[model samples]
Target: MDWEYFFELLLGGLTRGSIYALIALGYTMVYGIIELINFAHGEIYMIGAFTALIAANVLTMLGMNELAVLVLASVVAILYSAAYGFTVEKIAYKPLRQAPRLSPLISAIGMSIFLQNYVLLAQTSDFLPFPSLIPELEFMEPIAHIISSAEVIIILTTAVVMILLTLLIKYTRIGKAMRATAQDRSMAMLVGVNVNRVISTTFVIGSALAAVGGVLIASHIGMINFYIGFIAGIKAFTAAVLGGIGSIPGAVLGGMVLGWTESFATGYVSSDYEDVFAFALLVIILIFRPAGILGRSTTQKV
Candidate 1:
């Protein structure tokens, strides 16, 4: 544990935190609106990364430059994931909204399994290498260090996206509709808010964010398997819980906390036990402050 090691780990943690935060937003937004956990969200993330990878490879095969291919891939991945998310909501969850709550949860889980198997079948189950859009760079300051250009891009990209999302949700007309729907669906419908449209929009936005996260992480890590989403989803869900499930800002804070916790734990303890520390912290947080750090507790009317 030297200063350089500390800074490097911190930087890595922050980048990872950003990805987790993005994915957590998808979870929190859906939960806020319907109180159902979308287990397929992780699979959606996995597909996003793969979609980007496939797009980039196809562009390269068609003789496009790497930079251009990267741009196209990112755009395609986001759009594809957003559309897929919207469809999932319309076809899978929308019809079940009025049914028993457990129905949607089961459907989500089934979708998750289906996605995992589908990907495994379509593209070999073995881990595939992700394309690197950004070159590696070294910090030439007092502490010379190596950092990927992707890391810088991931952090900045995610930060800008988060800020834009905040603005969208806080100031835009659709944002108000989203809030109204989240508050009370029946009242929102009475007030002229199209509940279906709002829900669809929410899914599209959240899924697109997750897609961006998936692309960034895939580029940074360089390899991904179909099962990657399982752990990542759990961690993102933990982040949502840690930040107060329905609060957008809380997800960001929770993601950073969870990322830093794992980073420090691995640095001080053992990498083998990194996962244990993460869940342990989650349990501790839940036990002491179930509402989360920035979350306001609410009571349900019986």
Candidate 2:
């Protein structure tokens, strides 16, 4: 067995899983709070990448350092994405809060389609080059054969983000409110929790995370286009469902499992059927464990 080759695939899978977890975090969080899938979440991620690209270009023309440009561009993307998230919730979801579940769902899909078309017309269909934010460090030049600096950063960042998010949802006041809202929206409101604010906050947090994923992924891949969101979003959504749609830890676990599945398949078998293996694993898991790896089975008394 080629040990070096095996490690390379392992790290590659970790990187892929980390990025998927970043985006999946958004899907799971929003669903945890509002029980909505938020299909438009993916478009928010695409917008973030585009926003970062535009910001980086402008900053480079201003002769900023690489670090400064990356930081500023990512900030711009996150804030802009948050604004869009807020708008999406208000426009596409808030009005239909009391309506049938399908109402908001259809609205979410429509919003996703509208944003994709909007960006297509506004930006060229061709893939545009993205700036590399994570530069190769000199220290890692020796290990470059096994892993890249960007992959390391991606894995580390995802881990840190997951830890921080876990803390936020566990200890903070907003987190407590979110949990309450998720458990019982009507009871939360009765207890003076601003359900609207919690829901909006959920969207904002999810969008910001998605934006981070977008910027990092664009930098890693070195190019992106308007349609990138749909593919990434679908994979992330699958990760969420596979992990247990409403569970945060489950999302990350699901992403990692899916990532490793694809990577090992590509390494040992063929890249042609990479996605097939990933989805097949998901299907098998769902068949036996419908609640997901870390997900709890909840029975509504309704």
Candidate 3:
């Protein structure tokens, strides 16, 4: 066994896992708050990537520096993606809150389809090239042969975002309200928490995180298509379920594990079966530990 080759795969897995973690956070957060799966969340990530692509082109035309352009483009993409998230909740989800569970589930799937086609029509169906705005770090030249600057950015960004999210959920007034609502929506309302506001905020925050993932992943891959969201969404959903669907930390852990699984499978076995490895792992986890690594099992009164 080549140890160096193993380490290379490990680094690659970490970079991919970081993106999955960001996307999974959206799924887990929405589920944690409303007990609903926002299946359309992945499309939000795709749109964010497109938004960044357009923004970067516009900024480049204005002759901005690479760093400034990247920063501005990211900001614009995040804001636009958050708006879409808020709109999705108000239109597709809010009215169906009291309906049967399957109703909203279907609605979410429909929304996912709508967004994919919308992008296909608005933007070309072709794979668009994403700009490489992240500059190489000279200080890391010694290890540049092993790990690229983009991978470093991905890992650091994931860490920073996760820390900020943890702080927000722990310290802020809104954070407390979110926790209360997640614990018990009826009880939270009785205590004066605005259930609607909390739900909207959850969508917005989750969407923003997805946007960040989109921007970073697009930059890393250098190309994207309208269909990119579907596969990524499924993988992220699996990660969320594997880690304990409603557990925040579990999503991150699940993503990393899934990423590593794919990497090692591709390295040792066959690249064609990489996805099979992920699903196979998901089935095993479901059979043995349905609640996930960090998720708590709950019992309901009949």
Candidate 4:
């Protein structure tokens, strides 16, 4: 029972959890608003990472400062990811809004596959090395040896983004519209809340958050590939389900729980079962509390 070793695993879990939380937010938000699971959301994260990689290379060729390159590349990646989110909704989803539920589900899966191949062709099927933009910090030599600047950035950035999202939803007009639409789309439309705009905006915001997560994760891990999204997406989706699919706070909680489970499982148990641990947790949650940790049971009026 080494305390230091245990704490090291805990910090690693937190960092991974932050990335999962960001990706899970996209899942929960879209589900919360439209009750549609956008399976392609994970591909948007993958694209963001690739976009950032390309942007970083271009900036480096221009001899930009390291900090400037990181900042600019992240911005470009976020914007591109947001555009993809917006386009996917408009082209694939908006048309089938009135179709059967299964239609959209299948469409989402198809889109996810298409994006994977699209990247595989445009880029390479092989894993690409992600640029290391996060500068190393030597300032925290005294506190603990396990903690690093990347972990600190991941945690702090997640906190700030979550807080900003909360404030946006609570105080902003568009956020109010989103909430209204989420509660009841027909009623929101009756009250002049633009449901279409709200949904698109939701996708944009969610995609941007995912982009940030992708960038941070690429920097943390040092490499990425087109297929990275599939596994990460599934795990994030599981976190969303574990936390209560449509609940924002639940998504965050579920991600942290999943991360901790994986961290401890790998450290004490075996890395081979890291993913098994996540899915097992999901199955247990579904069996005991289907609605999720923070999810509430609902009754239909029909």
Strongest candidate by TM-score = 2
lDDT of 2 by residue, 1-302 (tens): 99988988999998899888999999999998888999999999999999999999999999999999999999999999999999999999999999999999999999999999999999878999998987888899999888888888888888888899999999999999999999999999999999999999999999999999999999999999999999999999999999999898888998898888999999999999999999999999999999888888999797
What are the per-residue Cα lDDT tens digits for candidate 4 across 1-302? 89989999999899888888889999999998998999999999999999999999999999999899999999999999999999999988999998999999999999999999999999999988987788877686565368877778988888888788878988999989988998888999999998999999999999999899899989988999999999899989988999998888888989999999999999999999988987898899889998999997777779
**Model 1 lDDT at residue 268:** 81
TM-score of 2: 0.98
Clashing pairs in 3: none
Superposition error at 251 for model 3 (Å):
0.6
Clashes of 2: 0
lDDT of 1 by residue, 85-203 (tens): 89988888999989999999999998889889999999989989997865555552333254467767887876787688789889999999988998889999998999999999998
Query: How much is 73 displaced in model 4, in angstroms?
Result: 0.2
Where is model 4 poorest over a 10-residue stretch in terms of lDDT? 136-145
Residue 174 of model 1: what lDDT? 94
CA lDDT of each prediction against the hidden true structure: 0.87, 0.93, 0.93, 0.91
Q: What are the clashing pairs of model 2?
A: none
User: What's the C-alpha lDDT at position 280 in model 4?
Assistant: 92
Query: Which of candidates 1 and 3 is the stronger one according to TM-score?
Result: 3
* Winner by lDDT between candidate 4 and candidate 3: 3
- Residue 214 lDDT (model 3): 92
Clashes of each: 0, 0, 0, 0
